[model samples]
Target: MAAEQGKVDPMHQFAIEPLFGSAHWEIAGYNIAFTNSALWMAIATVALWIFVAGGMKRELVPGRWQMAVESFTGFIDDLLEANVGKAGRKYVPYIFSLFMFILFANLLGLIPLPLALAGVHPFTFTSHFTVTGVLAILSFAIVLVVGFWKHKLHFFSLFVPHGTPLVMIPLIFMIELVSFMIRPFSLGLRLFVAMMAGHVLLEVLSSFVIDGLNAGATFGLIVSLPSFLLMIGICALEILVAGIQAYVFALLTSLYINDAENLH
Candidate 1:
């Protein structure tokens, strides 16, 4: 094991350890307990609330905080309107919350605090498939609910394009149906993999930096310097990726909702 050998384990960051005692609340043979992942998620949710609440002051002439929030709101509004048209206005609240939650969660994970000295480290819940999968399923469920509620059985027609020959109907329907079903998995996997990969890379580089320094000054100069610099660059890239992933998830969710809203 990397840890036993006095080396950093890149994968150790992803471990889901309980925050409380070792004993977990079990129901039907499954352990359910508060964890670092849950703690970070709760923190992100609270942070989002504070951010949005500060902006809700409703100044006659908006301040910087209000302006920042308005800018994000407008961005999502425009995205929804472009994809789903006027009806999208009603869904703005849901979509906006979703986007902000994800954005905050992603950003929070990258915060380098001194908590490690207190035996705490920031946890990125989005890197976990369980977290991402639940978010994806929630979005997908909304699409299904809205589609069925609004269009009833006609929603099934979404799998069939506007134009297709009778001979190709079966093949096209199966293909489209399969693609449709894969959306949730793809959406969740995208965020999970992106977050996980970035953190793993950072951890590995951090190990190199530590090991190189401990080995010798020459090795440190040769390996640690370059790795440290690359880590900085990668950290910057990861921040951008965090934002982009949130936007992509929101955009794709909006697009999927468009299909439910307009049968596109």
Candidate 2:
């Protein structure tokens, strides 16, 4: 209906607009400007810093904030250390920060305010690829670092299984190598896709909710009802996705590091 009204942009779903552009810095011919992605990332960083800092002052009988912080970090730290062993303790900060950043970014979007309300920068923070893509690359780099640190010359053996036949060695090596290379791609794409997809659903539903009220069509009312309900459902699921994706990314990174350490 909004499509018929000609108010909605068809390609607004994936557009990442730059706030301002300049020759601030260049990497690989791409100029680094203050973009929406960068802005939200900064917001995420500041928000996380403040949120965690507020809980940093611990007491013997911890308050809600202190307890929450302790529990959150303890859970991730324990899980990683248990599965990945003592060496994995080195990654506690990285994993914990990743989970917290994503959780804040996801929750930030759920802030209820009028769509036309000024001073709101939802687009800057939500589902921005540059922010997420860099995070993915960071995970990839950590795996590489840990693998090399632990296994030295033998880490390359990850490309070949221990019991593979000589005839199948080359093909298996290629397969494992490709799969290894694709981990970052899969990780980044999954999180970015989930964030983007969820926001798109929310926006489309909101459009229906608005248009239905305007048109007074019975079908519009029906569509709007489910759209509102689905928006609520997606919001809840997105909260889970936010934390889970961050955890999965960290978990996989730790496992890869462990594999590099064990090399078997």
Best by TM-score: 1
Q: For every model shown, what is its TM-score relative to the native structure?
A: 0.95, 0.86
Candidate 1: stretches off by over 4 Å: 26-30
Error of 1 at 22 (Å): 7.1
True-structure lDDT of candidate 1: 0.92
Q: Can you write out model 2's per-residue Cα lDDT over 103-135, one digit (the tens) per residue?
A: 777776555556437655465253666667788
Error of 2 at 11 (Å): 4.9
Give the backbone clash total of model 2. Answer: 0
lDDT of 1 by residue, 1-264 (tens): 677998999999888888777457788989877888889999999999999898998998999999999999999999999999998998899889888888898998987647766777889999999999999999999999999999999998998898889999999999999999999999999999999999999999999999999999999999999999999999999999999999999999999999999997
Error of 1 at 236 (Å): 0.3
RMSD of candidate 1 to the truth, in angstroms, is: 1.5
Best by lDDT: 1
Question: With candidate 2 superimposed using the best TM-score fit, by how many Å does residue 256's alpha carbon deviate from the native?
Answer: 2.0
